[model samples]
Structures are given as structure tokens and as C-alpha cells.
Target: MAVERFPVEASHIMMFARSVGDPNPIYHDEDYAKGAEPGGIIAPPTFVQASSQYDPDAALRPKPGQPWFGSGREPSGTPRGGGGGGGGTGLHAEQHFEYHRHLHPGDVLSAKTRPGKSWEREGRRAGKLKFSETITEYFDQNGELVITARSVGVQTERVVEQA
Candidate 1:
């Protein structure tokens, strides 16, 4: 995903912190943060993932007049397939983060993402498993790297059995 401008506001930090069940005063209380280690409010470590909301082309976000992804009258249908070979199931394998510094309010961030390494392997329950990585580098207003995030995705010929 490409993000031209993602403004980090205090309210957004608080909301994100709350959503993640993080109640640290350093995330909400300005005065407490003023004397804390960073000397100011800092967003949670994984808050950078929230940038997806600002990415207009993000696929997970439901637009107006569109059906919600959650269950309503009936259970939400199964998820669609992944990339690589068509009609395969997609799954998030893992996520890694390298933080140069804590995210603070008033910071404007931009992200540049590129594809990483991709490989294929055989699975027990699933047929062929194709693993791919996407790396997104977050830069601050000064163009300094703030966070390096790596997301791993897998495309399986079929859904793996729960173990």
C-alpha cells in the first residue's frame, strides 16, 4: 500500500491504543507523557498498521453502501483466495516490525512498500504453499525512516486443517 500523507493525531492514538486494550498513560495522558521516557505522548508499537485506513486502495476497508465484512443475518462467507495461483486461499503468515523511534502525535508519516522474497513449499494438509513477503518502510515528515514493517502472506492450494 502507498500512503501519501498520514497525519498522526492524538485522538487517533488514543483510539488505537484503546482498541488494542493498551491503557498505558503514556498513550493518552499528555501530562504523564511529558515526564515519561519519550517526554511526550507516543503511539503504540503496532500503531503504524493503522495506516491502512488512510490507504484509499486498501481492500479490507468496507466502503459506503457495501456489505459489512462481519456477520449479520447469516454468517459471513469464507474468505477469498490468495495471490500466486488463482483460486488459492490467502493467509497472513506473520508480521515483523523494526522501530527506529516511538510514533508521536503531530508526526506526518508516509509509507513506501515493495515486494520482498517469495518461495514455495509443499504442505501436509494443504497442497502447494507459496510464501511471499511485503516490506513497508514508514518515513516521518523529515523523510527519516521511522518503522520498517514486514508482512508475510501465504497462498495455499487449499485451506490447511486446524491443528
Candidate 2:
């Protein structure tokens, strides 16, 4: 995932925190955060994931003229093809985050991702499984590394049709 610019705003911090069921004042209350160690409002631990909204080509976002299966202004039908439950798109197996520093409001962040390692395994019930890792590093306006996110995606052998 590569995001050119992701501006961290105070309101966005509060909303993301609330959406994740976090009630911490450090995420919303500026006055309360002023007395804290960071001295200002900080984003939630997983708030960086919200950067996907800024990524125009994010995998989860449907392409133009493509049909999506969720609610929208107009009704659409779901695509049907894969039957083994993997749906061919793979599954999110794991997520890990490393925070170099607390993200404060007014920080313009950017992210760049690189592929990690790939491995395969045999699943007792699910059959063949392939796992791949993606490491994304988020940098601040000053080009300082602010956070690192490691994600693992797993796909079943059934994801591909046997021909």
C-alpha cells in the first residue's frame, strides 16, 4: 500500500477511536491530552489502517464500473464463482504494528509497502494454504518513520480453479 498523503486531523482521530469503541480521552480531548506525556491528542493504535481510505487503489475498494456486494446508492448483485469458501480473494491472517512515535494532529503521513516472505502449508481441513507477508512503513511530514505495519494474507489452494 502506498499513500501519498494522509493528514492526521483531531476530529478524524476522535471518530476512528469511537468507531473502534475506544473511549480514551487522549484520542479526543485536547485539554486532557495537554497534560499527558505526548502533550497532545494522539491517534489510536490501529488508526493507521484508516489510511486505506486515502489509497485510491486499495484492494478493498472496488474499481470503477465494478460490481460490489455491499449497500450503496443503487442495488447490485454479488458475484458467484468460488465455492470452497476462500472466495479467491484470500483472508487476512495476521496484523502487527510497531509505533516509533505517537501520531499527533497536523502530521501529514505517507506509507510505502514492500513484500516480505512467502510460505506454503497444508491445512488439515482447509487443504493447501499459501501465506504472504506485506510490510508497510508510515512516515511523517519530516520523513521520519512513525510506524510499521506487518500484514499476512492467506489463500487456499481452492482459490484457483484446477484446469
Candidate 3:
């Protein structure tokens, strides 16, 4: 999936930094950043994760009554995990990012997301666990690669009946 171009603004960077509990002057204070090595306000490392919000059809977004991948199925006539059968909710197993260059204000970035890998393994307690990975590469308006991020999701199959 292709995320719509996201315009990096100083305010967005500041807000994102604040949300992540980062008080770095380089991310929130343009004046301070200008005197730093990057020479302008730069976004934090995990800021690329917010690109999902710019995607209209982002799979991770909530959709009432729809079971998202790794989110277990709800048995018929049973409230979600109320009884009958149940499974573990989606779990983010891992995340990684490789920054090739600094992301600064005024840079319009776009992301290309694709499935990276999938596999399954036997689990002593869960019966079986499936793992899926996704990768998103962010590019600048000039078509320069800036960052690459990988995320893994895990779902475990039920090995015992719901109590």
C-alpha cells in the first residue's frame, strides 16, 4: 500500500516529539536545531510510524466488528472472548528502523508498505504461533530513500478451550 505524501512540518515534529515524551530541543526547538549539526528541526526516529494516519486504508486502524489480522476470531453467539473459543490478540513482536538521512521540515515523504515475510511455528502452550512481518520504506519528494522500517506481528492459536 502507498501512503499519501506526508508533509513534515515543525509543528508536527514538535507535537510528535512531545507525544513520545521526548524533550529534545532538536526536535521541538527550531532555533536550537538550526545551531546543531542537522541545521534545522528534525523528526524523531519513530516519527515514521505516524504515516499510518495519513493512509486512508491503513490495516491497523480500528474497524468495528471486523477482525484484524492477529486479532482472534469471535465464536458465533459469543461475545468477544466471552466464552466458547478465544485466542490471543494481535501482538507487536518487534520493530526496527534504518535511517539513511535526517528528516527535516518541508520534506514531503511517502511510504511504500509491503509484506516482508510470514511463518509459523509450534508452540507448546498455544498449539501454533504465526508470525507476519511488514516493511515500509519512506522516500523524500526528490525520490531519495530516507528510512526503512520493519514491524512484526504475532498471533497464537488456541490450545485449550475457553473456560
Most lDDT-accurate candidate: 1
lDDT of 1 by residue, 39-81 (tens): 9999999899999989998778877776664576767633433
Residue-level lDDT tens digits of model 2 in 12-58: 99999999999999999999999999898999899999999889888
- CA lDDT of each candidate? 0.88, 0.87, 0.81
Better of 2 and 3 by TM-score: 2
> For candidate 3, what's the RMSD?
5.6
Give the runs in model 2 whose Cα sits over 4 Å from its true position. 62-65, 69-89, 157-163
Sliding window of 10 residues with minimal summed lDDT for model 1 = 77-86
Q: Give the TM-score of candidate 2.
A: 0.83
Better of 1 and 3 by TM-score: 1
Candidate 2, which ten residues in sequence have the lowest lDDT sum?
A: 74-83
